[model samples]
Each structure stands twice: as structure tokens, then as C-alpha cells.
Target: MTDVFAGVRLLGPPETDGEYIALSEHETVHLHEYTRIYAVPGLYEHVVQERLRCTSPQVAAAGFLRAAATLGLEPDSMTVLDVGAGTGLVGELVRHGGVGRVVGVDALAAARAASLRDRPGVYAGYVVGDFLHADELREALRPYALGGLVSAGAFGGTHATPQALRNALAVLSSGAPVAFTIDERWMDASDPDGFGAAVEQLVADGRLDVLERTRFQHRVTTTGEPVFYQLVVGRTG
Candidate 1:
């Protein structure tokens, strides 16, 4: 698999609309073909984490820990919810940061299966359902009394919607720390449906209080092109 992955070359520009990777001596696949990627163990880690040099998992975990500290919350006293918890990388990081328990949520069942297979016991529970529309999801998660919400590389594009984010926040305890990363471009207030504008609405409505927001390289494309994202750390009102 290493050799197979090593032979891959990412197609240009890392455009959000579409991206491709030509596998060395193998085949090309759409970058977002998560179902295929997650099916094979270590493939996602090799491609996205090691090959692409993605940094969102580390950034999100660190940001969440710092935010939790700022809010005077003890990790052992709370259970954190990880949105778009792909393969449990962020969940493992948060756990290593002393978080007593972490729960993972993703729309794809493959993601849940991969997480359990690749990184066992990292998440106290992993929910496979739509964050916005799954009636069973919210009720299933409500029992945990989620204290913090954290995500990595899960927003923007066709991923989690702002409405989904709102629903997650509603389940959190007031003042629970929120940490996530999204493409910097999506944070723009100019795009009404974008996270940037959505965040403004959240702030204005007193639903969120941002503490730290910074831009950092999320990862590089197969062509060594840098992709940046905004690490947003805040607390719910």
C-alpha cells in the first residue's frame, strides 16, 4: 500500500469543486471518494495525513484543548463531540490531550467503520448519521451531555452545513468550547450561506463567542500546493 500510495500524484490547484489523484501504476480516484479511501485501512492516513501533509487534525485538537483550558473546563469532566470525525484522528488527538471521553459523528457509515477499525476505543461512541437531519442522531448524542464541539477538515465544500453546526451547538452545554477548522475562503461574510457569514450571525445572535481565530496551512496537495484553513475556537452562549 505504501508503494502504491507513494506512486500517486495529486492533480493541480486542489480546487474545492473537484480534485483528482493519479495513482502510480494503479488508478485515479476523486479526492473526495471517501467511501473507497476509507474501505482500505491506512489508505486515508497515507494519502491525506502523510502524503498530503494535512495539519487539521493536530490544529483542531490543540485549539480545542486550549479553548477548554481557557473556559476552566477539566477534560476529565466532559465529553467532547467531534463533528465530521473522519477515521478518529481528531478524536485520538483530543483524547491524548487529556480529554476523558470523545464522541465521533459523521454522515458516512464507512467513516464510522474505518474509525473503529483503524483507531479503536478512541471515541466513547461514534454516530453515523446526518448531523442536520437525522432525528435519531441528536437524541442518541444528547445522553452524553456534550461539553465541547471540535472538528477538523469537516466544514466547507459539500460537507457539514451551517445549520448542522447550529444543531450541534444546541446540544452542547452553555459555554462549552467549540473548536473547528474550515477553509479560509468559506469564512467570508460575503457568502451568506458560508461559514464566515454564518459565524457573524451566530455572534450577533449571541450564540457563539469566538476567542481565537487564525489561518494556518491545512495541508499540501499532491503537487505541493498549500491549502489553508481557519482554526476557530470559541464557546457557546
Candidate 2:
């Protein structure tokens, strides 16, 4: 817990009995490995923003705002849906940007608990279930009439798949705006991972606009290496 906005410094992951832990750090900490980090209230911030200098939440929110401005739509009029919402950090930013209502969907119950613990009143409703698995998720979302979907730093991971993205989008109104960011490696054509194909299809078929995309310093790795990611803002037209 240090001055996060000021700078990023390297700090190795928690150790027990001088044993080495196998944890990979990209801009912030790894999402999948949340158990060790989330045990401490602010340790996630310390490792992600302070030590690793991850700016994904901020960048993702900014990208959504930029797209809103371009479309001449006020953020306050939009009903926001945060897919893969981790602890409601990105939702907080979106709400601050004037989004009328915000709902968060996360696979882990820990995410919902952490969001309520860390940032209450940020999300109108927080659901604990995988979008791909839970049937109640769709029913719960029906009342929101979501106008925009903002998912930052939470795509193509083990929790989120192309099928899940398709399901999430299926719940939205037609041409709903969607903005998200992911590591650029996911965009590589040579990669056997299906992410490249999914993203390409989503963009090509007017399922995603892909308006603004830029490579920026997402955060530093645990080994003190800079991690770059592509932040994309777009409409789902």
C-alpha cells in the first residue's frame, strides 16, 4: 500500500517459508490467481497499480467515454453493464463518468463480495454467476435494458470465452455499445488461440465497431517488466 498513481515499483509475490511461488504478472496482478491477493484488502491495488502500474480500468472507462462523446450520447443516459467486472473498479469509473445505472456480472462470488466490501453503491446490482452457465443471469439482466457493455482487462481469459461474449452480447439491445481491452498477444493471427478469430468476426459482422484501439503501458510485470495492451473502444453495430 503505497502511492499508486505516482509510480510503479517491483515487489515479489507473497512468500511462505522462503518457497518460490509461480505467479505471472502482467500490467496488474493476474485475475485468475485472485485468492492470494484478495486475502488482503489493498494488496491487489498495491501489486496492480502501485507496484505494477496497471491502468486498465481507467483506460477502459476513458475509451467508453470517448465513444459516447463521438456518438453525442450522454453517459448519464446509458444503462451500463460491466461484464467480467472485477471488484467493481471499472464500474466505479463508469458511474463517475455519469452512467445512469451500473450492473456488474462476474463468475466468482468473491468478485461480488469484494465489490460490495470495497465499493458499495457503485453497482445497481451485482450478480454472482458465470454468464455462460447461469440461467438466472439472463433473467436478472432483462430488467436492466443495458445500453452499453464495458469489460476491461477481462476477456479471453479462462473465465471469459468467445461463447460467453456472444451470450453477453445476446442479452443486450441491438447495436449496444461495447468497450473492452486485452493484451495485444490475443490479437495475433499466428496464435492458435481462437481469440483472434472471435474478435475479427465480431468486428467484421458489425457486432463490434472497434473504433479506437491503441497500444499502451497497461502495467508492469512482477519481474519489473512493462506490459503493454491494446485498449479498444467501439459500438456494437
Candidate 3:
């Protein structure tokens, strides 16, 4: 019985479902193995929160609520589109934020299945596909007139490519808000083509405006080291 992905604690003897590992050799696993990871039941949670101590979902959701409050907007009036909604954790957070309708999009079918299996009714609709394409998904959610976007811990190296951001930006209604968090290490103020610079351009060009950004601990790596991320809330201007 081994829980290879369940954080640093050497829990009880590994059951058939859990993969146990020694403390020294744990940093090699990739993060997107949703099927293998989710199949272990509570491994994702244990690894993400118990082990890594990830808090992006909760932080981003709370920031969205506060920004909405600052604008005198009702959270219940928001129709939210959650991009890369792995396991529906972020979707549940948005629902808890009082969003009127939630549409979840993910590239992996296993993610959708896990969401339905573990957190049914948390999302109004779940679509499985690449979110970088706008045309196919546009009509699927047209009825909702989506006013907000939630993409917690989704944007990254390849997933957060400029083209992807351009496309995700195309799916929103003007003036709609978008909230997300990205690893701070992936960003740089001096690097002109960096993710942080791109997002800052989106804000400066009047396409968006940064409402709030807080540097916080997102979680831990397989090696028992803390990983930090920035929770960012912005609006389509």
C-alpha cells in the first residue's frame, strides 16, 4: 500500500489504491495525471491541500466575491465559465460564491467524470474539449451570456500560452470579469514576452484592469517544498 502522490506524510500502510513512497525521491511526478491521480479517491485532495497546501481556489473565489462587492454587483447575477475546471473544485467555489450559472470546461473526460461522480450538481453544465477554441464552445454557452470567468490554477507553461489567453478572452462578454492564479515563478516584469507581462498588457490596453492580486502559497511539490502563486482578479474593460 503506497500513496505516491498524497503529499509528504508517510501515512498508514499503503492500501491497494494508494501508492507509498520514500520521503527523498518524490519530485518527479507530473501534475496533470488526472485519471491516475483521481482514481485513488482522496489522493488529489491529500496531495493538493494536505501535502502541497494549495489554496488558489479558495483565495481566487474569495477575491472574486470581494471585487464584485466593491463594484456593487450581485454574485448571484453572474453566469460563470470555469476554464480548465479540473475535478470541479473551482466550479464548486464559484457556485459557493453565488454565481447564477456555472459552465465547466476541461480537456480530460476523466476530469468531467470525476466532477460528476464526486461533486454532482455543482456545475450547471460540463463540457469536455479544448477551451482554446471559441467557435465550438461559443454557441454551447451562448444562452448564459456569461459575465464572469474562473480559471483557478489552470493557466501555466503551455496551457497559458498567449494564443490560449487570446482565445479565452474572445469567449467573454465585454465588461465581464475573469479571475485566475498562475505560478509567480513563470512571470517576470522585465521579460517582455512573459505571462505576467502579457496579462499586464491585457490590463493596460483597456481590455482588462487588475482588481486585486495577492501573492500566496498555492501548494507543495513532491519534494515537500512550498509552491507559490498569485491570485489575480481582473475585469474586461
So what's the TM-score on candidate 3? 0.83
Error of 2 at 16 (Å): 19
Tens-place lDDT digits, model 3, residues 1-237: 235643445333234433333334543333555676666555666667665577888887777777767777788887788888878888898787787788898878888888888889998888877756667777777776777788877777656565566577777877777788888876676777667887888877887778887789887665556778888787777
Winning model by TM-score: 1
Clashing pairs in 1: 187-196
Candidate 2 per-residue lDDT, tens place, 159-206, comes to 577677767777777666677888777767566555667777887887
True-structure lDDT of candidate 2: 0.75
**Pairs with backbone N, CA or C atoms under 3 Å apart (clashes), candidate 3:** 1-14, 2-14, 2-18, 2-19, 2-20, 3-19, 3-20, 4-19, 52-220, 54-218
Residue 140 lDDT in model 3? 74
TM-score of each: 0.93, 0.83, 0.83
TM-score for candidate 2:
0.83
| Model 1 spans with C-alpha error above 4 angstroms | 1-4, 13-17, 23-26
Candidate 1 lDDT over residue span 1-237, tens digit each = 677666667776455546777755577788889998888788888888887899999999999999999988899888999999989999999998999999999999999999999999999999988767846788888778789999997878789888888887888888999999999878888999899998889899999999999999999876787999999999999
